[model samples]
Structure formats: C-alpha cells, structure tokens
Target chain A: MKTIFTRRFPASVKIIAIVVLSLLLVLSSDSLAPARQYLSTFFSPLQVIASAPLEALDNVSETVKSRETLMAENQKLRQLELSISDRLLKLEHLEQENSRLRAMLGSPVVTTQRKLIARIQSVDTDPFRLQVVLNKGIKDDVFIGQPVVDEHGVVGQVVEVNEFSSRVLLIADNSHAIPLRNQRNDVRLIGLGRGDVHQMELQYVTKNTDVKIGDMLVTSGLGDRFPEGYPVASVTGIENRGNEIYSTIRIRPIAQLDRIRYVLLLWPELATSDASAPEVLSQ
Target chain B: MRRSPFFTFLIIWLSILCAALLQILPLPPLVDEYFRPQWMLLTAMYWALALPNRFGIGSAWIAGLILDVLWGTTLGFNGVMFGLCAAFMVENNHKLRTYSVWHQSLILLGLVLVYQMLFGTLSSWLDDALVTNSYYASSFITLLAWPWIFFTLRKVRRRLFLS
Candidate 1:
C-alpha cells in the first residue's frame, strides 16, 4: 500500500478513480446541500457582476421604446387595470359569500397565501435542467418547496435556498410535476413537464375524461407542494389512442417559463398553523 | 517555463475566472438555448493541451466543480466529465499538439460530443431531465471556436513567458 501510494497512477487508473469518486458524490447529493448553499451564497455577488451588462441592456431597450408603442401599451394596461378592478370588487363579494357559506357548512376558512417578489438573477444555461437563480433566499424567508409564480401564472418551485440566493426548478423541467385539475370540469390530473419551454404533459387522464383543447388547468393542491387554484397550464393537444388506457394530453404552461424576469414566492399560511390543529379541523 | 510560479498560477486562474463569467452571462433566449458554447470546457481543454503537466486531471476537476456550483448541477457531475476529458487530452497531448488546427478541431468535436453524451445521459438518468438534440449543437460551435481560443491563449502565453 505504501509503495502504491508513492507510485504515480496511470492516466486510465486516475480517470477510473475520478469516475468512482464522482459517482459516490452523486449518490450522496443530499449531504452536499450545505456546501451547495454556501457556494451559492459565495457566487451570488459574482452573478450580480456578470448579469450587470444584461440588466443595463434591458433597461436601455425599455427606455428607448417609441412613443407610439409606449402610448399603446399604456392604453392597453389602463384598460386591463380597469377590468381587473371591476373583477376585484366582484371577487371580494364572492369571497365574503364563500366564507359565509363555509361558516354555515362548518368548513375551515381559506387562508391567503403570503408572497415575496424576487428578481431572476440568472438562468441555468444547461439545456437539460430548466432552472433559474433568484435574488432572494433564506435571509428573506425563502425556503425549499415554495411555489413560485409570475404575473401570468405558476412559474415553478424553489428547490435550493441559501443566504441570499435560491434556485427555482421551472415547471417546464422534465423532472417537475404538479397536481392539476381542469378549471372547467374540476377533473384532477398530474401535469408533468416535457423538457420543452412551451409544453407539459398531463399523465394518466383516461380517454373518456372531459378534457379538451384550451381547457385551463390549475393546481389542485392535492400534493400540498403548491397552493390550490393557481393557474398552471392549458391543454393544447390530446392524443387518445384506441388501444391505450390513458390519453396523452399536452399542455402549454400559462407562465412564460423561458421569459420570466421576476417571480413571486408563495408561503402557504395554513401549512404552519394547521400542523398543531386537529386533523378534522384542519381539513 | 521560465515564468515565476505565482505568475503562471495567476494567469491560469484568471483565464478560468473569465471563462466562468462568460459561461453565466445572459444572452437572448434563442441564442442562449441553442448557441451558448461550453466556455469552461474549452478553457480547460486549451490549458490541458498547452501545459499537460501543469493543468491535468486535477485542474479539470476544479474547473468542473466551479461550473457545477455556478450552474446548480449535482456537485460532481461536471467534475467526472471534465476529469475524463482532461485525462484523455493529457494522455495524448504530444500527438494532439502535432496535429493541424482543423484536425485538432475535429478531435475537439469528438471530445465535446463524448462530454455532452456523458453529461446528458447521467443527468437524464439521475435528475430525470430530458436532453434534446439541440443540446448537442453547441459541440459544433465549440469546435468552430477552438482555433480562436487556441491562437489567443497561445499569444498570451508567448508574450508572458517567451518574451
């Protein structure tokens, strides 16, 4: 053993050693969480420096937009704001009525989700993993498994958090899956990302299920990872093979997965309080 | 070879730092998704070929770890691929340096393809992420960019050491 240690290993032996070591590291990734977090914090300032030029370019382009286009955009936004305000008034009344009905039925009250807005610091360039680093983290009460959304809809979830930065696994990543229900029919299904920025797959939906093109899917909240009723995706294609038991339902995620510049992190209010509550009361 | 050890180490680290920065710089979505070259890999390959004794398997492993942290990949995924790439280059450094630039580029294409294949397969298996055909397009771009990186680094080495 002493002689072997003193002798220089051949290149092939060295390569095999590295391969074995790395495989071990991969198998024990959970143990490396602290290291990953510390490194993420250390790299946060460098990421800011690297992203500075891109931010400046974005600002310049925003400022240089033509007056006509700006005016049209402003007009469109004003109309949208007015409509949203109208809906908000009606929504408030509906919420009050919903609470009254729930009280009469002796059901638990719905809790509002707490949210924090975070700027996207950088996107993972690896074509395989769809992830983004956000500029908020544990210091800001960010935690793993927090549901992330943009103005449009559900963006992804926080996978790793450090002192000042966190990584979001986008809904379009192949490994990510969300519990979704058809907004129109209330049929629950699992939405799985297909690794495309524009697509997701709804798994195990039977052919006879009342799903159609353009049916909006929202979080069912069955998995407890995401809050209920957040828009997730919309059905785009349904391939119902006569011989197959389940139909292949494709969807387009409502959130602009690739174009997101900012996302809102949601902290579910019930998750904390309901843990101590009786199971029946919590339900 | 005559340069001070500190100076040599500083140059190597500075080059690696610049490559890391370039790796993370945001480009437009289309270009970023399809055209982004593997800057760190290219830099490691350049140094490993130029000075095999100085920058070998260990250097490549460090570079890969840096990339893993920056890209938020599993810690040692890039390390394995990078160490293997560097080892292959170091074993054949003498023959590789003697080849023409085009031939060297062809060899780089092969190396990068293997790197991507290994990375993609492991990621897909371990992380369950899908790898598309366009992910391999960057290897071609990396091949195209090799001569430029080679000439630029060679000039830097000549100016800093030979002069």
Candidate 2:
C-alpha cells in the first residue's frame, strides 16, 4: 500500500480529482451569493475608471461634430416648424371642439403617468447578455422591473438595483418577453427576445392569423410591467403556412437599442381608495 | 528565498485585474460577437507554462471565479475551464518549455482554441445556444495575439525573476 502510494497516480485520476475538488470548493463557498452582488457593485468603479477616457473623447469630438450636424438639422427643422405651426393651429381648433363634445358626453380626461429621467452611465460589457447599467438606482426610487424608455420608444426594464446603479435588461435579451397587440387588427401576441439587438419574435400567433408586414405592435399591459399603448415593434415579416401550427413573425424594435444616452424609468402608480375614487391615477 | 510567495500572489492578482480590464474595454462592432479574448486564461496559461512552481490549478480556479462574476456569468463556469486549462498546461510544461518559440506559438494557439471551445460549449449548454462561431474566429484572433503577449510576459518574467 505504501509503495503504491509512493508511485505516481495516473494523470486521468489527477484530472478527475481536480475537477471534483474545484466543484467542492465552489459549493463550499457559501458566501458567493452576496459576493456576486458585491463584486458587480465594487467593480463598477473600475468600469467608470476605464470609461472615463472614452467619455472624455466623446465629449471633445461631439462638440466639433455636432456643429455640422446641428446646422443641417436646424435647416430641416425650420421647414418642419413652418408645416407644424399650421397643423398646430388646426389641432387647437379641433381640440376645442372635441372638448365641448366631451363635456356634453360627460367623459373624463385621461392623464399619463409621470416619468423619472435617468442617464446611461455605461453598458454591460458582456456580449451574450443584453443589459445596461443606469446612473440612477434604488437611492433615486428606482425599483426592479420598472419599464424604461427613450425618445423613440420602449427600451427595456430594470432587473437589478444596487444602491447607486441599476441594471436594465434590454428587450433583446433572451429572458424577457413583452405582451403586445397588433394595432391594425388588435390581435394579441407575446414578443420574445431573440438575442439580437434589432429583432424580436412574436410567439403564439397561429398560422391563420392576419398579421402582416408593417403592422405596428404595442404593449398590451397584461402584466402591468409595461404601460399599455407604447409602440414596441413593427412587424417586418410574417411567414404562415398551412402545415405549420405557428407563424414566424419578425419585428424590428421601435427603440434605438444601441444609441441612447438618457432614458426614463417608469414606475406605475397603484391607486388606493377608501370608499370611492377617480377612474385613474397618474404618479 | 529568491521569490517571496506573497509578492508572486500579488502579481498574479494584478495580472487577473489587467485581464478583467481588457475584457471590459469597448470593442468594435464587427469583431465584438466573435472574439472574446480569454485574458485570464491566457495569463494563467502563461504562468503555468513558464513558472509552474509559482501558480497552479488553484490559482486558475480563483481567477475563473473572479471572471465569472465580472462577466455576469453562471458560477463555476469559467472556474472549471480555467482549472482544467491550468492543470493541462502544468502537466505539459516540461515538453512545452522544450519547444522553440515558433512551435510554442502553434501549441499555444491550440490551447486557446481548446479553452474557447470549453467556454462556448459550457455557455451554450447553460443558456441554450447563446454562443456561436465555435471559436474559429476567436482562435484566429488569439493566434494573432500570442507572439506579442508571449514576448512581453516573458520579458517581464525574466526581469522580475531571473535578474
């Protein structure tokens, strides 16, 4: 037994032992749970440190580049402003008539929930994961699972919140699904993330469905996670066959997935009433 | 007595931090998806091949754990891969040391390929086909990075350890 112990063990045996022992160590490290959150929080300082140079570069270049872009955009906006002023005058007259009609009909006015604005500090560096780290977190009343939006449309929702920063999972990630309704036909479906930035898949739409290319899809607000009526995507293609049970519906997301510096995190306000309350409340 | 153990440990930890920093740096869109240079694995592979006495499987696993956290990956994913890579490199260090730098470059390319393949397979299995490209592109990029990385680290090792 002693001689055998003195002899070298087989390399395969050593490999197995190494794997087993590593697994055991990982299992025994009971502190890894909080350590992960701590590491993410602690290492964000490093990301900020690393991103400072790039951010400085951006600021320097942006001032020079924006002069040319703003000049061209300003000319375009002048033409648009002339056209919109005429439309706005007509719209004001129509709105007055519509309000009189609404008063006679005894209908109430609808108000939207107020939005809290936040800035994008940095994006998650992982390629597989689609998440962004925002500058506002729990300290700013940012809660997990709150919807996020930019000027174009809905972008994503907050998933994890630290004291100073929150992680927002974009709509393009695999774990997220947004309930949507086709604006043209009111057909409801769920849009699942396809792991690509610009694309999402509409699931559970049957082959006989009437969804087509260029159909606009909006949030259904079934889960109350995202507010209803916000534009989500436009269907780019729809494949339906008699033999297949489901249609392959592709959509291009309305939000600019790659180019947002600021966004709003929307927290839905719940209404509580003692005896009788108004029809809606916005927070 | 020539190399204090604590100092070596500090260097290893610093190297791992450098690796994480490299991972976090913004990459161009064209090369972003296909190439994730295994910075920690490369560092461990270097130390195990050149100074086997100073670092080993345990060091590799710890670096892997740190990488897993930094990259927001499942626990033990990189840890196991790093452990296996380190163990293999150490076991073959003698033969690896005997090779010329050119031959070593090719062998190191193969090692990088293996390491990437392990990561690709493990991550795809965990998340259901999240990883693609199968290391073909990463292998090319890693091969390109090998000579410069090897020479630089070798110069550092010589200056720090050999006098």
Provide TM-scores for the models: 0.89, 0.79
What are the per-residue Cα lDDT tens digits for candidate 2 across A1-283? 1221242555466568767865664565455545555666776765666556767878888777867798998999999999997997897676556546656777522313456778776533445677777877667777768899886788999866666677788897876789999899899899999878889999888887888899999987778788777898999988877788998988999998887778877766542212122232222
Error of 1 at B142 (Å): 2.6
Q: Measured with DockQ on alpha carbons, how good is candidate 1?
A: 0.53
> What does DockQ give for each predicted structure?
0.53, 0.39
- Interface RMSD, prediction 1: 4.2
Best by TM-score: 1
Task: For candidate 1, list the clashing residue pairs, or say none.
Answer: none
**What's the TM-score of chain A alone for every prediction?**
0.84, 0.71
Report i-RMS for every model: 4.2, 5.6
Please list the Cα RMSD from the true structure of every candidate, rounded to 1 decimal place.
Answer: 5.2, 6.4
Docking class of 2: acceptable
Instruction: Give per-residue lDDT, candidate 2, residue A84.
Output: 90
Q: Which residue pairs clash in candidate 2?
A: none
Model 2 spans > 4 angstroms off: A1-33, A65-114, A121-124, A271-283, B33-36
Q: What lDDT tens digits, residue by residue, belong to model 2 across residues B19-128?
A: 77777666655665566566667877887777666666667777787776666666687788888888888788788888877787788778777877777776676654
